[model samples]
Target chain A: MRLAEAWRVALDALRANRLRSMLTMLGVIIGVAAVVALVAIGTGTKQQIENQVEGLGSNLLLVVPGRIQAGSAPTSSPLTLDDIDAINRVVGDRSRVAVTIASGETVRAGSRTGFASMQGVLETTPTVFVRNLDRGSYLTRTDVSTGRRVAVLGAGLARTLFADRDPIGRQITIGGVRFRVIGVFEPLGQSLGVDRDGEVHVPVTAAQRLLGTERIDGIAIRAPDRDRIGDLSTAVVAALTDRHPDTDFSAVTQEQILGVLGDILGVLTGVLAAIAGISLLVGGVGVSNIMLVSVRERTKEIGLRKAVGARPRDIGLQFLLEAVLLTTTGGILGMLLGGGTALLVDRLSPVPAALTWWSMALAFGVSAAVGIIFGVVPAQRAGRLDPVVALRTE
Target chain B: MTAAIVADDVSRTYQLDGVSVPALRGVSLTVDPGDYVAIVGTSGSGKSTLMHLLGGLDRPTGGTLLIGGRDVSTLSPDEMAALRNTTIGFVFQSFHLLARTTAQDNVGLPLVYRGVGRRERRERAATMLERVGLAHRITHRPNQMSGGEQQRVAIARALVTGPSVLLADEPTGNLDSATGQSVLALLESLVDDGVAVVLVTHDRDVAARARRQIVMKDGLISETR
Candidate 1:
């Protein structure tokens, strides 16, 4: 028989038992949908994290004391301004090197008070990082050199302390010491789970005096070009290691961070797809069972067809076609459903989701395979039926 | 021209739970085009077995059976099916029409195996249905039709491929006497068109109407007249 006729016959058979066909298809529908939606969510999160990591800065490297591997302890040798000067000499550009010493402190302006993360930074912070000023000027070299008490309020902190009033040149007390605000930074929502707009920046020298600490948290360096980042990292890590021979310094780039994070998220996506595949397996079993029942029910029909002229091959082809048709239809519906769910999630929720063509293709391919794998035994049984015996069935 | 079907000393022994039981023991028969013959017997007397063998649904285990001049033992299962498609048509006692399909599609089924195109198959099926006096009921499913009409539809389905031989097994058994007469008349009408008609029946009245009769006793033919 022609393939088209086989398909028509299969379709007619399915239509004859529309309710049973639909119920049998439901399992595959849910399985394919779950795979598409879950994979979308996983990939979307990976993309979101990548964007945030890249948003930190271009051609940037973060140097932290001690190894950044799992279960590593902090080094006893803290990063000092002398170490910064040593790195500055090697880098040949003072503006590309910056460091920060962080402390959480409460600030007061008049009767208003708010807690904020206080970051002691140098004049070169704005150049080394991606921060932009909304009003007034950022810290100057003279401010850091003279130990002048000056601060830059973040967008959120400025709103809290001064509200409608201008925050630049306003006085705010930090740890019982007063400093004049020199600038207000533009709003930066969040990056790497840190609230950028909730920080207050001060001159490192003045901050050291207020906090009574000389230890620095970390160093940020901007390479001259993208390709030089690796070379520059090696140089800076060597310089820091030279000063503190007992400690190991690690310089991490954005790509390294993204690679590690992408690995974790990729595994998570695979696991979710695997879990969804279990349901597809179950659906395939259901298809096999239903097809067996259909074969049993149509034994007399098989006998009649054989008596008329149908070959065993034709009978087998018809049944196999029926199974493939069932699953492929279910697969298509599930794709629409999964794509719709992904679209809905992307729009209505904070959790990101994106559908890829490959995932859709994979789900479709698997569904068709499910049909073939589950269809074989029943189709063979129908083909191998003894016509005389089958005709004897009522 | 070759006979439509020729069986020479054919025998069929079936295995039931590893024990052999002979259904047809050395029965020989010859049917020519335009012939009308009937095989009559009580249940389990091997008339059905002979019909099945002549239809090419089962091969004879002993002796030679030729359908369309090809020996039954020489044909593969697929070749046997192809021979049946081109040379033989079947009508069952219970009207074995697909329950959910229209009369037209059910009639077109044999052509489907012959690789006939859909449109041509439908046209031929309609023509055959009309020939069986079911022109107005072409679209009706079997369940919607009366017993007589369903048997006519089955006759239409059997004859749709324009085969050389038509095999009817108790074709009128399920119908009322009046309806059975009409169905039997339809089968007789096809023999005039040079198609051999072979009928298996237990009804003496039905057997009397045929041009030839073979009565079987046990697994062998007891009489031919």
Candidate 2:
């Protein structure tokens, strides 16, 4: 049969049964919508996790001091200035690698007292890790070298110590030694589950003096060449081993963290996509049911067309196209709904929702395939009907 | 000359509920161009069976059947479909003007199978409808028209294909006397135009209108008068 005529015949038949056709298309629509929505939510949550991880800084690596086993004095071989100096020298291109060292100490400001993480670092430490300083100058390299009593306080520390008062330049006592307030770091919300802007910064020598311990317990490192993270880690580990043979330490790479995160996202996407696939099967079954009903309804028409010289293949194609067109149209609408939903989520939530272009194509392709697959039984039924008996049927 | 239609020693049987009820047995007949032949029979006389075989709607279980100079006794289903489309036109008793389709589109149907362009096919269908005095009803659906009008539309549809022969199986079976006579007159006129016409009917008056009449009984032509 000619293409236009076949299409006309199919459309006329569908129009003859309007309610049935719409009901049939509804299955496809719901299937498509479900697939899109499920995938979008799953992928959106994954993106949120990635951003939360990334907020810790792309290059920053954390190292915690190994504590002495059982009741023994806290590892005397703590991360020291010598170890920090060795790490800095090993990755000497300052543009690429940076380091921060910190220790825990009791700090007293006016009448308030708190156990604060007193970090000994350069001014650039705030910009690299914790960010957005609200008040004063950070402890610079010159301050570390000279053992100045100037301190840079965390937002939380400042709030606790001075309340609403200006505490910059005010003197705070640490371990019975008075230190002048220099700068305040802005509130960087939650790093590794702790509020970052809740700490304090002072010159390395001043921190050692105030604590009466020349020990550093924590160091955060940044490497220059991301691709050479393994080499950088090796260099740091070797340098640390050489300086303090008995001091056990460990080094980690952000690339490894990123990989673990990627694997999680990939698994999540796969699981969500599989769940969405169930809808396609349901949609296909729906098409088959609809097609079967259509065949039964149009029995006389099929016979008439056959009597008028319609080939079996022509009859089959018309029914197949109907199903394909219905499913594909549903897929397109579902994709639009999915995209809009993702955009809405992105707008409403702190997490980002991304709708990749491939996702649209994937959705559409699945829908078309669904139509073809599900429409087969009906097409075959229509094709196989004997015209003589069909015409005689009431 | 090759007969317009020929059935040599034809036979057909139906397997109904696992039992064979023979519809045709060792029947043979020929129709030539411009011959207005009518087959008369009561129910179960196999007149409908003979029509189906002659029109190539069903193949004979035995013997040769030729239509438009081609032996279609062993033709594929698709080949038979093509033969039916191009060589013969059927005028069913019920008018069979497809429900919900415009008269023009129904008439233009053969051209669609023949792959004619849309515009020209519609024009030809219009001309055919006009020939049947139904030019005004070109866009009317079958259900929207009267019995005679619907039969006229059916006639227009059959004539639009310009086939070698026109076969009418009880063409007047569903119409009133006036409508049936008009439809018969239309069929007789096609004979005037040199198109062979074979009509099947039980009506004696309808049979008498044809140039020749064949009486069928028990799956065979009992007499020709």
Candidate 3:
């Protein structure tokens, strides 16, 4: 028989048992939808991380003491202010260099107390990183030279300590030492999993005296241009290594961090798709089971068709087409459902979700393959039935 | 003209549980165009088996059985199916019309296997339904029609392929006497149009109306007239 005619007969058969057909398709629907939505969420998280990393600052490089490879415990930093001055000479632009000595400390203005990430930094911090002040002036050369007890409060910390009152020029104590708030930073939300607006910046000199430590945690440098980052990183690492012959320093660019993160998330997306594909496998089994029942139920009809000169292949083709029709239609509905869910989650939540074309195509192709793989046995059974015996069945 | 079907010393043996059961043993028969032949037998008399062989639904285990001059034993299953499509039509006692299908679509089924297009299949089915006096009932499903009308639809389906032979296995078995008479009259009318008619029946009166009679006893023909 012609394929079109076979398709019509298959469609007619499915329509005859509407509820059963729909129930059979449900398994496939859930499977495809899960695959699409999960993959979208995974991809979106990866993209979000990439954006935050790039948004840190253009042509940025971070130099940290000790090795940065996996499974290594952090060693005590030997980096000092002298190392920063030496690296400043190598970059030829002192404004491009910055350093931080980070400590968790509690700060208080009157009875209002708030915990903040205390970032001991130089005046060049705003120039090296993407940060801005909302009010008052930032620290200057004399602040680090003379160890001035002046501070800048993060936007969230400023709000918590002073409420509506102006925070600039107010007295706050960090690590139980009295300091004046010289400026309040603009509101910068979470980036690279850190709350930028909940930090306090002071001169490295005062932070060392207060915390009783001369070592710096890390160094940040902004390249003059994107192309100069490689040369600048080599120079900074060499300069730091020259000072501390017994210590190791690694200088990493933003792109390397993104690449590693992207690799990890890519695998995560694939794993999610694979887990969802298990449901599709179960759905295929359901299709096969229903098709078997249909074949058994329509034994006499099969006999009739065979008697009417339908070839064995024709009978097999009809049943196979019915199975494919069920899954393909189910796949389309699942795509819409999944796409809608991804869209809703993207719009309504902070969790990122991006629907990729390849994921949709992969889901669709796998569902179709599921139909064919499970459809073969039942169609064969129908084709191989003895016409005389089948016709005798009630 | 070639006989529509010819069987010479044909035998059919069925295997059941590793034991051979002979359904038709060394039986021979011939049916010609415009002939009306009725086969009468009780259950297990092999008349049904003989009919199945003549319709090309099964091959005889021994000897030659030909439908439309093609030897059944030599033909593959698919080739036999093709031959049956071109040369034979069948009407069952139960009026095995597809339920929930209109009379026109039911009648067009055989043509579908013949690879006929939908428009032409519909046109031909409608014409054949009219020939069976079911023209007015063309749109009615089998469940919506009376037994006699459903049988008429089956008959229309059988004849739609323009086969040379019509095989009816107790075509009127499910109908009332009046309705059975009308359906029998429809089969007899096809003989007048030069088609060969072969029927298997248990009713003696139904057997008596045919131009020729063959009475089967056991697995072989016991008498013929």
Candidate 4:
């Protein structure tokens, strides 16, 4: 028989029992939907993390003090400004490298008070850290040299302290010292577990004096190009070790952190996808069960067709087409439902959930394969039915 | 031309729970084109078994059965199916019309298995329904029509493929006496049109309508008149 006729016959049979067909398709729908939704969430989170990592300035390295060993006594030695200068000297021309330091503190403005992070930076901090000002101006070389008491508020901090009012020129107290807000930083959103929009920036000298410390917390260095970041990191470590032999500090390149994070997230995504695949297997078994019942119920119909000169292959093909149609249709409906859910998640939460073409294709391919794999036994049973016995059944 | 149907010492045995029971005991018969033959017997006398074998619905365990001169036992399953499609047609006691399907589509079913295109299949089905005097009821489903009308649709479906012989097992068993007479008259007309007809039944009055009558007793042919 022609394929079109077989398709028509299958359609008629399904339509005759609409409720049963829909019930049989429910398993496939849930299976495909779960796979698509979970995979979309996984891929979306990976992309979000990659974008945040890339948002940090290119060709950058961080230097921080190492913890004391278990048996060793605590050391009061911390990285200082002199260490930054010595690293610059060892890394070649000063123009090709720059460094900034930061410390966490609480700041208050009149009736409003909140915990905030404070950064002690040089004139080139904005360029090296890829920060931009929303209004007013960045600190200059004289601000650090003269120890000026000027500060820049991050966007979130400004909003919390002043509401909708402009924060430039307003006075804010940090660690019990009053300073004028010279500028407000543009919105940067969250990155690397730090809220970039909720920080306060001041000159290194003013921060050192106000916080009662000449020791720096940590240093961020920018290389002239990506290719030179490795060499610059090695040089920074050598210079810091030479300057403070008794102090333990570590310098880490950006790629090392990204590589570790990618590995962890990749495993997490794989586990989630595997869990979703289990539901698809269950759905395939449901399809097989329903197909077997349909074959049993249609035995007389099979006999009638056989008597009318239909070959065994034709009977098998008709049933197989019915099974495939059920699954592929369910798969399409599931995709729509999953895509809608992902869009809703992206809107309602900070985590992004995006559906990709390849994931959709994979879900569809798996559904079709599931249909064929589960459909074969029932179709063969219908084909191998004894016509005489089947006709005698009714 | 060769006979439309030739059965030479054909036998069929059924195994029920591993116990062998013979259904047809080496019965031989020949039917020619344009012949209206009826096989009459009581229940369990193997009349239905012989009809099934003649229609290629089953294979005899011993001896040979041929339809349109093609040996049935030698033909593969696929070839037997093709032979049934081209040479023989069947009408059943239950009228076997698919419920919820229009008469036109039900009549076109045999041609569908023959791979006929959609438009031609419909045209041939319509023509056959017209010949069976059900032209106006082509769009009606089986349940929408009377028992006699449904049987007419089955007859139309049987004749749509233009086969050489028609095998009908109790074709008028479910109809009233008046309706059964009309159906037998239609089959008589078909035999007059040069298509051989084989009718199986237990009703002596029904068998009396045919030109030849064969009687069966305990899986063996007892008489022919």
lDDT of 3 by residue, A1-394 (tens): 9999999999999999999999999999988999999999999999899888987788899999988999999889999898888998999888999999999999989999999999889999988888889999898989988999999989999999999999988999998999999999999889878998899999999999999989999999999888999999988898888889999999999989988889999899889989998998899999999999999999999988888898899999999999999988888888888888998999999989999999899888988888887888999999988888788889
Runs in model 3 with CA error above 4 Å?
A134-137
Chain A TM-score vs. truth, each candidate: 0.93, 0.78, 0.95, 0.89
> Can you give the TM-score per candidate against the true fold?
0.95, 0.86, 0.97, 0.92
- Per-residue lDDT of A96-145 in model 1, one digit per residue for the tens? 99988888999999889988999999999988888999998999999988
List, residue by residue over A328-358, the lDDT tens digit for candidate 2. Answer: 8778887887788778878997655777777
lDDT of 2 at B162: 86
**Per-residue lDDT value at A17 in model 3:** 98
TM-score of the second chain in each model?
0.98, 0.97, 0.99, 0.98
B169, model 4: CA deviation in Å?
A: 1.3
Query: What is each candidate's DockQ, to 2 decimals?
Result: 0.86, 0.58, 0.77, 0.68
Instruction: List where candidate 1 sits over 4 angstroms from the true fold.
Output: A107-114, A134-137, A155-170
| lDDT, candidate 1, B1-225, per-residue tens | 889899999999998999999999999999999999999999999999999999999999899999989998999999999999989999999999999899999999999998899899999999998999999998999889999999999999888888999999999889999999999998999999999999999999999999999999898999998
List candidate 4 stretches off by more than 4 Å.
A65-78, A90-102, A209-214, A241-253
Best by TM-score: 3
**Clash pairs detected, candidate 1:** none
Q: What is the C-alpha lDDT of each candidate?
A: 0.91, 0.79, 0.92, 0.86
DockQ, model 3, C-alpha based: 0.77
lDDT of 2 by residue, B20-127 (tens): 888888888889999899999998999988888888788888888889888886688888888888888888888777777899999998788778888998999999
Per-residue lDDT of model 3, residues B63-109, tens digit only: 99889998888898899889888899989998878888899999999
